[model samples]
Target: MMQYRVEFVTLCALMVLAAGAWGFVALVQFAHAAEPHGFDQRILLLFRDPANLSQTIGPAWVHEAVRDFTSLGSVTVLITVILIAMLFMLFSRRPGGALFLLVAVVGGQLLNSWLKVLIDRPRPELVPHAAEVFTLSFPSGHAMLAAVTYLTVGALCARVVHGRMLKAYVMSVAVVLTVLIGISRLYLGVHWPSDVLAGWCAGSAWAVLCWLLARAVLSRRRAGEGLAESA
Candidate 1:
């Protein structure tokens, strides 16, 4: 009981920290004053070759690695993750867990789309894009989705997992993957630093919010069942 309580408190603290950080990021984005194209150019340029903007500042193999990480945030990849996680939940006879991620992920995507339109920020042209992009770049869809998918799924799995070390391992992988995908966007010159940062903030906040909601739903369901048994 104490362990569960500790874990719950830890998750709560993380969610609050993530929310506060995201708000700060949004404030910075808002205060950029005219959305200057060069707001983060100096750092961005460091990722690309100075003379050849189309190429990344690394060996050929490094580009391949970045692409692999970026693919985790792709539409097909995200969909696959959702389907697989849902299947796992259903296989385990936990439909609620499955439903939670589905709603959270799809909702996060919609929220991200709306935010992009509202911000109307363009892709970074400070350095030539090493990757193709089709959507507005205020908040990176890849970054946000990575956070939503990995963190939500990780937290759910952590609850069912038995050991503290194992749970830490799971959530750590999720955070690392989220961070990598975000960095890949910058390395590929496809998103501004601000875009990736905002995405991380928004995504983490949304995932934590959904997790808490799921817990509430589960608690109420259990309570209702308990009352029926007592009756």
Candidate 2:
């Protein structure tokens, strides 16, 4: 039964990875075309005031709130969270898990940077940006990093958690944070909707890939120990 469960999880992760990769590639093609997609512009404009494109569609507080949420995905905040989580894992005597998380998140960040440079998509100019941006906008770095870090952390937490409900809650919170961060980028007019979508696809795929690799390594280690004990 445990073997079957592991197989199921492996299968599901592979499926998600494939789907995400496909979606990202499709978006890349669209983004690379001579003309930008109309939907990208249309979706971005939806968040801006019709009369004055310089302003967002909500009260001052809403803009500030969105910025706050967006900051959750920022490099500074994410790295701080990661460091805290890693220290907790180390102190708990789960050094391997801490290392796994560090590699996964840092790898995801490097991958995001490479993709951004490769795609070279420009930031949206249809509306005034509500927040500062310093990177290329093919895949919103905030969206991608949010998905990578939060989902990876959630997965690690779920593994140690006791009950199904608790596990689901952790994962749901991760998903919610990832979604909200991506949407905040849209609302802030720093990224096109396509950019956010592609970020999610790429980030999710990377996270699953890392999980699968970690699982494979553990399985091999366990098998080796079992064989040695029998001998």
- Highest lDDT scorer: 2
Model 1 earns a TM-score of 0.90
Error of 2 at 212 (Å): 0.2
Q: What is the per-residue lDDT of model 1 for residues 63-159, given as tens digits with 9 covering 90 to 100? A: 9999999999898998998899899999999988899989999998999898888878878777777788999987889998999999988987897
Worst 10 residues of 1 by lDDT: 24-33
Q: CA lDDT of 23 in candidate 1? A: 74
TM per prediction: 0.90, 0.98
Clashes of each: 0, 0
Error of 2 at 58 (Å): 1.6
